[model samples]
Target chain A: MDPLILASEECDIAREVVCVPANVLDLFEFNSVPIFIGLGAVIIALVMYFALRKPKLVPGKFQASVESLISLVSDSIARDVIGPEGVKYVPYLLSLFFFIWVGNLMELVPGINFPFTSRMAIPLTLALLTWVIFVVEGIRKQGLHFFLDLIWPPGVPVALKPLVGLIEFVSTLIVRPFSLTVRLFANLVAGHVMLALLLGSAGFFLLGVLGGDISVLRGSIGAAWFVVGVAIFMFEVLVGFLQAYIFTLLSAVYIESSLHPQH
Target chain B: MIADVLILAEEATESSGIDLLIPTVPELVGGVLAFAVVFFVMWKFAWPQMQQLLDNRQKAIAGQIQEAEAIKAEAQSLLDDYRQQVAGAKSEANQIVEAARSQADTVKADLIAKAQTEAQGIVGKAREDASSEKARAMTEARQEVANLSIDLAEKVVGNSLDRAAQKSLVDNYLASLEGA
Candidate 1:
C-alpha cells in the first residue's frame, strides 16, 4: 500500500468523476448524461405541448412568455443575423438554445447537482451537428466552390495564398467545432468542479466542527467557503444562460456565412 | 488496509474516467434522436399558429384604416352638399325680396296715374255744366222783357183798336226803329 494513494484519496478532485448508473439489464449501463438529456427532452416537449396545444390569436401570460422566448431566438439570432431566409431554421435553433439551457440548469436543481453539458460528449455532439449543418449548407448553395472559396478568401495577397488557405482550413474545419465544444464544456465543468470542491471541503469542515475536532477559525473559514460556493452557484446560473445564447448565436453566424459567403 | 483500498479506488477511477471526455455511441445516438424529435414537434405545431396570429392582427388594422378613410370622405361630401343647398336657399330669398320691391313700385305708379286722370275729368265736367246754366238763364230774361213791353202799349191805346191792327202797328214801329 502506497502512501501516495492515501494522500490522493483525501484530495477533493476525486469528486469530479463521471457517475455511471447501474446496468438495468445485461445490455447497457445507464448514465447521468443520457438521463439528463432525456429529461431535458421531456421538459421541452411538455412545454411545447401545453403552450402550443391550443394557440390563440391573443396570448395569455404563460403562452406569451413562451412565445417571446421563441421569438427572441428567431428574430435576434436567426433573422437578424441570417436574414429572411433564416425563417426556415428558427425551430431548430430554438430547440438547440432551450435544450442546452435546460441541460445547463440541471446543476441548480437540488438533488441533481450536475449539469449534463459539464460532460464533453453532449457539447461535442452538438458542435458536430452545427459543423455538419453549416458545411452541408455551404456545399449545397455554392457547390464544390464552397470549399474553394472558404479555403481561399478573396482579400489575401497572391504570394501568401497557400499559407492563408491552410490557416483558413484548419480554423474553419477543425478549430471552430473544437472551440465550440470546449467553450461550453469547460465553462460548465469548471463551475461544476469548483462547486464540488467548495461544498465538499465545507462538508468536511462542518463534520469536524460537529464532532468537536475542528478549531473555531477553521469552522468560520468553512462557513465562508460555503457562502462563496452559493455565490458561484448563482453566477453559474447566469453563465448557463449566456453560454446557451452564445452557442446559438455562433451557430447562426456560421449558417449565415454559409448562406451568403460573399459577406 | 485503508491505503490498499484507496490505491485500488484511484486506479479504478483513472481507468474509468477516460470515458467522461469521450462520448459513448449510445448517448450520441440518443441525443441526436431526441433533438430531432423536439425539432419536429415544435416546427409542426407552434410556428404556424404564431405567424397566423400576427398576420390576422395586421390585416385587421389595415381594414380599420380603410373604413375610417371612407367615412371621412363621405362626411366631407355631405358637408359640401349642405353648403351648396344653403347657398342656393340664400340666393332664392334675395330674389324674392327683389321681386316684392319691384311689384310695390309698379302698384304705386299705377295709383298716381289713375288719380291724376280722374281729377282732370272732374274739372272739365264742372266747366260744361256752368256754361249751359248761364245760357238758359239769359234766354229766360229776354222772353220776360218782350212780354212786359207789349202789355204796356195795349193799356195806353185804351179799349177800341182791332186785335190784328194793333199787332201790325207794333211790328211796323219796330221795323221803322230798326231802319232809322
Candidate 2:
C-alpha cells in the first residue's frame, strides 16, 4: 500500500501509525529506535575494538583514522572546551559523539530509514545524561556554592541582580537540557521529514510517469523532486555530523561551565 | 515548515499537547542502557589503551631526542680532543725541527774548526820536512864537492901532500863556505 496515498485517503490512519506500544517489552519488540540504539552501540564497540586491536607505534590507515577521531573528541572537544580536567570525561564524550553520529546516520541507511534521535525520548535520555554530568560536576567542583553562583552571577549590577538571577536560574538549570534535547531531536526530525516528503513525492510522481500517466508535468516535477531529495540527503549527512559535533561541544561547554563557575 | 511538520506529526499521533515531546519509557531506557554500556567499555578498554600508546610514543620520541643529544655531545668532545692532540703534535714537531736545526749548526761549526786545525798541522809538518830535506841535500853536495877537489889535487900535485891534509883542507873549505 502507498503510505502517502493511504495517509491522504484517511488522515485518521495517522493515529494508528503514531500509536506505538507502551508496554516495556512490547515497545522493545515493536520499536526500531531502541533496536537501532543497540545497533549503534555495537557498531561503535566493534569499530573501537578493531581500531585498537593491533596497537603500533606507527599507526596504519584504520588506526590512524580512529586515533584522529579520538583526538578530535579528546583534544578538540574535551580538552579544548572543558580544560585539562576534561581528560577524565573523554570516554563518555567519545561514546556520546559516536553514538549520536551513528544514530543520525541511520536516516540514510536502507533497511533502517529512521534516525533514532528523531525520537524525543533518545535525545532526552542523552541530554539528561549530559545534564546530570554537568550538574553533578558543578556540585562536586563548586560544592553548594554552585547553586548560588548559578542563581547569582557575579558582576551583575545591584539593580538588575534579581532579574539576572531569575534568568540565569532558568537558563542554567531548565533551558540547557530542554534546548539540547529539542535541538538534536528537532533537527533530525525536520531533516527526516523533508527527505521523506521529497522522496515520497518523487516516488509517487515518477511511478505515475512510469505507469504512463498522461502528464509530462508530473515526470518533470518528479525528476526535480528526486534531484532536490538527493541534495537534501547529502545535506543531512553533513547535518548528522554537525549536530553530533554541536551536541558534544555543548556538553563540553556545559561541563566547563560547571567546573569553572564565575567568581 | 516546522508548523506543517508538527501539524502532520500531531495528526499522526492524534495528540495535541506536549505529549509529542515526551519519550516512551522503553526508548529512553534502551538509549541510556546502550550508551552506558558503550561508555563503560570505552572507559575500561579503548581509551586507556589509546592513552597508553600515546604516552609511550611521546616517551619514545623524548628518549630518542635525548640519545641524539648525548651522541652529538660525545662526538663534539671527541672532535675537541682530536683537535687538542693535533695542536700538541704540531708544536712538538716544530720543537723537534728547531732542535735538529740547532744541532746541525753546532756540528757544522765543529767540523769547520777541525778542518782548519788539520790544515795548519799539515802545513807545519810540510815546512819541517822541507827544511830537513834542504839540509840533507846541502850536506851530500858539499861532501861530493870535497871528494872532487881531493881527486883533482892528487892529479895535479901528484900526491904532493897527505890525504889527511887534503881531508882537513876540504873540511876547512866547507866550514868556510858554511860561514859565508
Taking the candidates in order, what DockQ does each have?
A: 0.21, 0.27
lDDT tens per residue, model 2, B38-147: 89878998899899989989998999999999999999999999999999999999999999999999999999999999999999999999999999998898888888
| TM-score, cand. 2 vs. native | 0.76
Q: In candidate 1, what are the lDDT values of residues A136-249, reduced to their tens digit? A: 999999998888889998788989999999999999999999999999987887776566546555655665567776576656656776887799989999999999999999
Tens-place lDDT per residue, model 2, A1-263, is 32334443332211222211121112112355688889988988998889887788889999999899889999999999988999998998998888899899998997676788887888898899899998898999999999988888887888998899999989989999999999998899778767766665566567666777526664666677788889999999999999999999999999899999887
For model 2, the superposed segments whose C-alpha errors exceed 4 Å read A1-31, A107-114, A141-145, A155-166, A194-234, B1-22, B110-124, B158-168
Q: Chain B of candidate 2 versus the native chain B: what TM-score?
A: 0.71
Residue-level lDDT tens digits of model 1 in B36-105: 7777766886677667666876787888899999999999999999999999999999999999999999
Candidate 1 regions exceeding 4 Å error are A1-30, A207-216, B1-18, B60-180
Pairs that clash in candidate 1: none
